[model samples]
Target chain A: MPTTPAPGTVAPAVHLLAGALRRALLEEGGGFRLARVLPGREDSCAGLAAVRVLGADALAPFVVKGLALPAQDAALIRAAVRAHPAPQEPERQVLLWGIRDAALVRGLAVSGVDATGWEGLAPAGSTAHLLRLPWVAMAAELVRVAGAAPPFAEEAVHAQLARSHLDISRGLVRALLRRDLPSAACLTRWLAPAGEQLTTPALDYLEIAGADDPRVSLDTAIARRLTTGTSP
Target chain B: MTRANTPISPQGDHDDAADRSRNVETETDAAAARLAHQVGERALAWLECMRGSFALTAETPDDHVEGQALKSLAELALAAGMVRREAIAGPQCADTAGRLLDFGWRQVGRGDLLYRLQARTPAATYPMEIYAPFAAAGYRHERMDRLAAHLLGLRASRVIEHVPNRRLAVVAAAATIGVTVPDDVAAMIGQTWLGGTPEPWMLDAGNAYGVTHTVFHLTDWGGRPEGLPQRLQDYLHQWLPVWAEVFCETRLWDLLLEMLIVGTCLQRPLFFPAVWERVAAAQRADGMMPNGLTTPPADPHAAWRNHHHPTIVAVVAGTLTLSRAISHATTAGGEA
Candidate 1:
């Protein structure tokens, strides 16, 4: 079953599979069962896209459900890696390498993954990357699989977050008002590591800024869980 | 005073836009102070040119202060008094401010209309709010102050209902006229939205107005930053930039300047180039900043109706920024 209710009316394959993964994550004590897709080349492509969109987060729900990876779901990670190549840009490579690293770092029951893949993607801890998108998703996956908080501990990252707190907060508010619900939710999740209560009031705005999309719930759920130290 | 033949288009993504934004972000204290003074003066000049258009109509039975032109002139009185009180921006502003103050006082028959209005509704604070600026400038009327003193003592006056920020405005006006009863001020400040120090990012347009007015009242038309407590001061220091960005991007020129005024209300003010550059770019060669992204009307009356408040906001905001910038520089220089 989809974790956060169906998006309804022929949702895209990436979202459908992502929603299933997110649902499995929030289960807390439930078993992991990968959602079944139609048998076609398109289905295989969609699965890899979902795996990329989630990066490490694609496998996080299985870990949360406390299930050892079946070879079939493990094959999804292997296929995603084979399908996607590392990029030259530091941020893009960090994002690309994150999928393989998550599977390895969490020591999932996946096979044929390169142990040295993370070394090829150097500067994996860029400060600017920590401020942008996909970082939050990757971060949420890390938190779920490894019981780690966001790694905003470096001094440069700390200073950057402090200096740009207003900018980040402004982005979230603008997204909420613009009704770009997914971006707003991602920003909400991204701001979870702030020492002060950066968005206690803004959390309510997310409820009112509701979207029909399940990714909104997934991002918001991760944010609330991170901040409150509770299950979604 | 060379006005462009056509309006300077608002900045686009050209290299100059980046340069201008960077210039504002990196200016020295002397540079920032000069810009603030110039911005304030151009806005006041625009207001002075439109002075004749603030025509009053006879009071209708409903007699809402906001529904009458009297409110506009009264607001002009506050802006003029601020320019004169700060008294350091420039002589041109000072001269224009003196003339404008005389014009506003004359428009109200030199406090006679104010006295009559207060007499009719002893509990109505509007006339007294108008009268306070005149009194503060040594233009006090014996009869008006006596009536205001009586009004200030009344239980009805103390209990006159207003939204919390409006209540703070009334209290501020009473302080200017030297007639506020003490506890009313405390209770009023406690009830204001800003006083609560709630999450400022959630502020929409309405709540923003409430917060801006609360700052205007607390700082006493930008005359006294000391009036704002340290807690509220901290709240504004952390939050005003986001509000400024929110308004500037949405093209709410009035609220954007209102936030700029709040910027100056902090105990320690700094030049915010990113927000200020957008505002400077938005102003026309004639000094009119449109209230929104909508093209300003060609008709004078329509333009005035649409833009007068943002113009007034520009005046006060620029002046306060100028005044506070000077204060901040002088203080820093002394410390050095």
Candidate 2:
């Protein structure tokens, strides 16, 4: 079992990754600028070096050497870290932080890795969904940025980015990222598409019909779908 | 419409800070109680207002009469201790003011009331006009209308307490239609109703008329279950369908479904299990469900999506309701 950090200690490894990623973006322009400025053009130079040191990958050694977790656990953490590389773009970096933050806070361990050293990352369609996650402080900062910036238009890319971080089945975030609709209506449309493709129908139904909305038809549709497989 | 021109601190008060604290505490308590009472009383008054046979007629009170009548009545009512000034200034009073303003505009447009008393009334006027009879009843019609309008503007600040974005839209639609929702529901709308002309949708004759009818159903007609279920059902069946057809997308459809499930748990318990079963049955192995039965997928995410949060909440709520119902049924069977 992975050793857990004390409450007051540095946030568990996953959080460290998210926090470090966030700090890299807000304070240090993330690794992109450092990569650009570095002489060797090596992946581990400059800002990328700092991320490698402090992010999810760095936690394995600390857990193995400092916390005394098994060597195999550290190896697993190293492997997962290698698989999900640090995000390059500032927006993608923030999104990674949000997903990891949500996962850690929820106590969900990433599979095939040290749960304590987990990094949360998920695909999200818009800055709005990224901000809507439960990480209050980070989400708030992101919200502030979103409010100041122009509305995001690249829904497909954002959706892909969100999926990479979380365990949400495909297309869930994409459905949420579509043009604004009343909350209830949006959920209804997501759960039960009028289209013929039915992959992952249960999850879609769950996603769309779980929240509130002002539009009554959306609710009715969900209720109808839930009760009769027909929109009410 | 009167702005506070003079600042008067209560006399014999302590230092400014102490006085301010005491004033704030007293004002806050008073405001709370006053709002509570105003909301309750105005709701009652609205019921009464709609009870009698209301007909749209072609009579317009003279503008001067309307003005003087309101001023004299305010003074008499205020002086004679018949009505408190705060009664006209309270939150409920503001809600009334808003409704009446909408009502007045509708009446004018319908040619039931003249636009200007001095001008020729519309050529084809409806009979049985409903003018501001309160002016004749010793209340200031114009001032009362003004006070209502002003109060409505002030009360709009409450809208800010609601939730944001889509949630806000839901609460706003409810408020626009004069549906008194619980505080939690109101909080969903998340913005103050700053003083401005009400939205066109809010004031639209059709919506306004619909509100009047809904209010009547809620109050006088004693519509089933206080007309809440019926009102909600009507909104789902009629108003919201149109809105969905017009502006809603697949994601919005998902959000709406969640709201309905939540709403069913909150408002209509009987329908909970049926709704849940239908949803559960429709779920595919990968956990995606269709949006509406017949409509084309509104978006790509309409397929291959799994949202755990809403599912968990719905499952929990549905399980509880089902357990209780089953227990009830078993007990009844034993007794039989």
User: Best-fitting candidate, measured by TM-score?
Assistant: 1
DockQ of each: 0.17, 0.02
Model 1 regions lying over 4 Å from their true place: A1-11, A33-42, A62-71, A88-115, A118-125, A128-171, A193-201, A204-208, A230-232, B1-32, B57-67
- What's the lDDT for residue B234 in model 1? 82
Worst ten-residue run, lDDT, model 1 chain B? B1-10
Candidate whose DockQ is highest: 1
**How far is B85's C-alpha from truth in model 1 (Å)?**
1.5
Global lDDT of each model? 0.65, 0.31
Residues B291-321 of candidate 1: C-alpha lDDT, one tens digit per residue: 8879988876779877888888888877877
Q: Going through the candidates in order, what is the number of backbone clashes in each? A: 1, 82
DockQ of 1: 0.17
Off by over 4 Å in 2: A1-110, A117-232, B1-33, B36-126, B129-209, B216-336
State interface RMSD in Å for all models.
13.0, 20.3
